[model samples]
Target: MQTLETMRSLGLLTPEQYLEITAYVMVNSTPEQILAMPPHLWQAVMQADALLFPGGPAEPVH
Candidate 1:
């Protein structure tokens, strides 16, 4: 899997959420799609989902 710089660095996603993102994309996307995706795009995707950071972004609680 492509290890794109994830949103974890931004302190938005918990470690668990970061792993889930990696796994989610791995299961849902082609290797080419994953590799071609920019870090900002990944950030945008993660931020848009409440599931990724539940409790409405109060803190990084997996």
Candidate 2:
């Protein structure tokens, strides 16, 4: 999994852009891995996850 910092350093994206992508990924990705992400990415992931999983937030309930 590529981190936002890593993507930024690689010039693949800005921090904000990466955050947005991360959020998108969270919404589509399975719950186990999304839940495993580090704290820094949690908010972005959750936002995306919510958007993607509009029926409900992705789980392990966080």
Candidate 3:
């Protein structure tokens, strides 16, 4: 799973911008794809979704 800190460090994202982008990605991405992510990256993706859109509906899980 990628942390906000690590994503920032990796230049994949900045801590602040990652929240929305990660959520969008997670909603669209498959469970298998997400599961394949490193632990820190997975957590960051989940946390980003939860933070930006608490209780919000994700994209259809396909």
Q: Rank the candidates by lDDT, best first.
A: 3, 2, 1
Model 1 clash pairs are none
Most accurate candidate by lDDT: 3
Query: lDDT tens digits, residues 1-62, model 2?
Result: 45455545665455686766667565758778666666656655455445544688436745
Which pairs in model 2 have colliding backbones?
A: 27-49
Worst lDDT run of 10 residues, candidate 2, spans: 44-53
Question: Model 2 off-target regions past 4 Å?
Answer: 3-5, 30-62
Model 3, span 1-62: residue lDDT tens: 35554655665555655665466456758777657766665665666556555777678978
**C-alpha TM-score for every candidate:** 0.39, 0.36, 0.39
Q: Ten consecutive residues with minimal summed lDDT in candidate 3? A: 1-10
Provide the lDDT at 34 for model 1. Answer: 69
Backbone N/Cα/C clashes per model: 0, 1, 7
**lDDT score, residue 37, model 2?**
65
lDDT-wise, the better of 1 and 2 is 2
